[model samples]
Target: MQFANQTGGNDFTLQGLLNSADTSVPLFFAFLCIFLVTISGNVIILTVVTMDRSLQTPMYFFLSNLSFLEIWYTMTIVPKLLANLIIKSNNISFSGCMAQLFFFVTFGATECYLLLVMAYDRYLAICKPLYYSSLMDTSTCLQLVAGSWVTGVLTGLIPVLFISHLNFCASRHVNHFYCDIPPLLELSCSNIYLTEISIFILSLVVLFSCLLLTLVSYVFIVNSILQIKSNSSRNRTFSTCGAHLTVVLIYYGTMIFMYVRPHSSYSSDLKKFISVFYTVVTPGLNPIIYSLRNKEVKMSVKKIAHRVLPSGFKKTQKNVKSIF
Candidate 1:
């Protein structure tokens, strides 16, 4: 496949996923469905969490933040991905590419920290139930959310700073779907030793550190659950944490494999496959996972659906009558 011109000094061409005519149509529609579902599902999660009085606890508050982040996180990449599928010679300006990279990394790191916070939240709730409310009060929850965002922004910014300054005299055709760090680094003509080391160190420090802490929190959580006398209560306590742990495992597993490895180990096909999982598949699946597993969220969703469907049907009926 012929790539875009290298003549445009500030533009990099992306060899997007499944550019073949036979697969493009099906892939585009599939991703469109996923994108729509991802957006609508997360929106429902946000609305339900906000409206449900019973879900006003610290756990649901963090969940709402997660839903909010998922919306923007999916938004950052999916639209461009859809466009790239249709528009074969997908070229992005240097600034636009950098912006996309920044937001993607920022959201990614924010998710890591947020998951850590959620794990810690569970730790407190299960291991120290008596002090849970006082320790994770409204003020403290807001501060934790704010800190995660701030930390993500800074983490994303530093990598972009290093990347933007690098000389891109090599070919401008990136062999991946979006502006990921690995592909962009591969395209750079400059000395990338420093850039690679810095990013690798950051990824290790940020991703693994969070992973380690989350594991420790879960260790304590499991121990606390085991100590409970009643089997039903023990199962109930473990149930509350099941969804978060599932999400954490899926998200962290894909991300660590993608970002933490050496540059020489990069495989274009493997990278693309992994990217689709975290970026498209995970976002679409997250709300479903959380809502399906949590009884309260299901009840809240049913309440919202009941409240919305009638009004929507009425509007459709009125429009039909006016047309007639």
Candidate 2:
């Protein structure tokens, strides 16, 4: 159903990554590959973590949560994007747009909180090793995960609910691949001062606050690592935290630049590229970044492969021998 726009309609058209017919097929295949990798990688992480008793620690638990989140996070936008590319019609109903905005924001914010929780987990593990198990018990881990989801939902709801009521009498064409806060605000004909202010405040509170907490945790972590007299211990500690730090830099760098700025400052083309980076590229890279560099994850994957492959190979050999 169409909502009222400038021309008195509810349907909004998304201006996807590229509009040329020549590029559509290539873009579709490219994104399809990325999407598949994103899903499969995350699924592998989840499966490995769940199956292996060795991966049942606080660290792997959070890594599994992140992998699970990335699956949904990528799902929210990439399918529609793939559809838009093939069909060449970017029209999304008002309800669909709002729904997309809701889930996208929810997952993104939830990730921020989850990353912070992970940082704290690492801090406890490194800085206060003796009490790590006691402090980050099963109950605490569950609560932190629960809190991140709840906070993400609540935070995401505020902007969408507010934006949904605004009059989009200016235009129905959104200049990005997805329904994001800045693009939606740009479409509003109504006075957006209060809305912008609210969003800015929320950004500072939600995004910056979590970033600050993560930084503080890392500070303590670094200090603890420096205190270790053994070079091997120091190297080991750096290796463990390095993956998370790499992810943090990439995710936060794009996100903060996109969301924390004034709506007027948005350059549609630049924002679109940045949006693609965070939404599409980052999700696919997360599992690789976290797993390829991680010895534990690599070990877990090898163990699972051995467990599953050898039995299947034996059965196949038995069938071949019987046939011969």
Clashes of 2: 3
lDDT of 1 at 304: 62
Looking at model 1, report the run of 10 residues with the lowest lDDT sum. Answer: 1-10
Considering only N, C-alpha and C atoms within 3 Å, which residue pairs clash in candidate 1?
Answer: none
- Model 2 misplacement above 4 A: 1-9, 312-324
lDDT of each residue in 1-324, candidate 2, tens digit only:
233553344688999986678988998999999999899888988998999999899988998999999999999999999998998779988888999999998999999999999999989998888999999999999999999999999988999888987888536889788888888887888888899989888887888899889989998998988899999989987876776687787888888888786555656788888888889999988888776557687667667766778767656545433422
lDDT of 2: 0.85
lDDT of candidates 1 onward, in order: 0.85, 0.85
Off by over 4 Å in 1: 1-9, 236-240, 305-324
User: What TM-score should be assigned to candidate 2?
Assistant: 0.90
RMSD of 1: 5.3
